[model samples]
Target: MTEESPGAPGGGRPEDVRHRLVEVFGERVSASVPLAGLTTFRTGGAADWLLETSDPADIVAAVRVTRALDLPLTVFGGGSNVLVGDGGVRGLVVRVRHGAISAHGTSTVRADGGVTLNGLVRWAIQRGMAGLERWAGTPGTVGGAIYGNAHFDGLMVGDMVAEVGLVDRTGSILRVSGSEMAFGYDESRVQHTGEFVLWANFDVAAGDPAKLRAAARESLGFRKRTQPLAQASAGCVFQNPRVTDDSLSGGVPRTAGALIDGAGLKGCRVGGAVVSTIHGNFIVSDGAATSADVRTLIEHCRSAVVDRFGVLLREELVYVGVFG
Candidate 1:
């Protein structure tokens, strides 16, 4: 699929590729870098070549280089809600490091993809921007948030996105509006296609600073109370189940955690992978978890829920590399 692109650069020898990359990116590029430390789960293998960049220009350049060299590439963002296999990623990994945040107007703010949702919310609140306070304690970068259409309580990150700048697999930067993104619940066009967001503009309205700060605090407090915040988990392990029978779910929303908990799988473990006692949807790694262990635990939870309630749970996390 990669080679078919029009004007795709010809394949090159390994030595030539390495020399070219070193000349272009210098010390920022490294080989055989372990990725577990870079992710929220803290349980992955290595990336073949990891390019860390805090500049959008760097991200673009890395993409262009990889494409020109005909190498496999992955755009790794905040590393939240993603599980990596122990086998590691095969080729070039471009880690987005662009973290700048600035206001374009009184009611709008622009942020780099590497900016965390937690940071973005605080930035918005400080600037009297009103739309993102609900995500005060959300995990992942702005790019990851947009990729998954991140949400909390009744608010979603997609709701406030005004525009996004993306780098296509062919290394072209394209700007598009929010609606053009094909946003859905915990899904977006980015997930379907491989386009990577470099930065985004969010639309917010005039808000009282004091009120926004208080609301942000309250939202954060709620997360700390309800989630296993202190543990190492890749956010929610599963997306909320869709069920038509309201009575089975207590006439309320049917969440993945509730279903798993109801199936009596909380604290169920396979090696270091255990369902979080506080939130059944999360599988926390106790510093010794393996990709296989987590996969087994998730399967156990899925089977139990399906056996008990006839509902299939979808995963919210994306897995990179080869899964056993």
Candidate 2:
């Protein structure tokens, strides 16, 4: 079957699609899998079809099958930056969990897409490598990090990337260099191309272990002090406004958190979702919060900021599945 091939059996039927997937993927595929436990927010519904594998080959095969069957495909990494809707996802969800890291030549380390950013940081620190130590407390997988050009302080993950191995929409594997990634503030070319990252090689430098550990610890400490790490949240709710209108803020910091705080939205609540008093940008759940609750709170914060400062804040959190 080809990318333009017709759907198999009862076209677009859920059971038919599941059966076809089972035939192709065997035990690797599951039906109606719960999604809440798979994500950092710990909320949302199920995936109609789910494929969890540690093999890049399996990832490519799944994409091919889904494309041939005319089913929608979604790639989930560490599930740290998305809000899956309660209505659930309509098709297959692919989560790659292979996290092997190896030295590429002398100055590069190749990490499987599933490797947690923090895991990569620790790996580099343990080996006395320096570049990743500054991102010690970052969440999600390397794939997700690169997809969003994950940043800390003033540095972006893209800055250290050497190359990326990805499965493009056509199910063809390709190696894209860092320069070709088109990384920007919270974005990469893959987002537009619908390509799936299988692994990435990052540039590293030799460093003293003690110094690397110290830097990693400092990054972790800063996150613990500033963010509500204890609560269930999807990191930052909004991207910091890129361009600030001076007439609106009157010298207030243009950061998303600062704008929300200055708008006096701290401790604001919608159902079980509340804006963290510790950091205005984080919307934490009180264990029982629903996706709807968090989403509503996000809108409330956005509205408040726009009304007060004439600045419409954009979301940093990605929405997955479907909402009611």
User: Which model scores highest in lDDT?
Assistant: 2
Q: Which stretches of candidate 1 lie over 4 Å from their true place?
A: 1-13, 243-253
**Candidate 1 lDDT, 225-275, residue by residue in tens:** 999988889989998865565445544338898888989999999999999
Q: Candidate 1 at residue 244, lDDT?
A: 60
After TM-score superposition, the amount by which residue 245's alpha carbon in candidate 1 deviates from its true location, in angstroms, is 8.5
Question: Backbone clashes per model, in order?
Answer: 0, 0
TM for every model, in the order presented, reads 0.92, 0.94
Worst 10 residues of 2 by lDDT: 1-10
Worst 10 residues of 1 by lDDT: 1-10
Which residue pairs of candidate 2 clash?
A: none
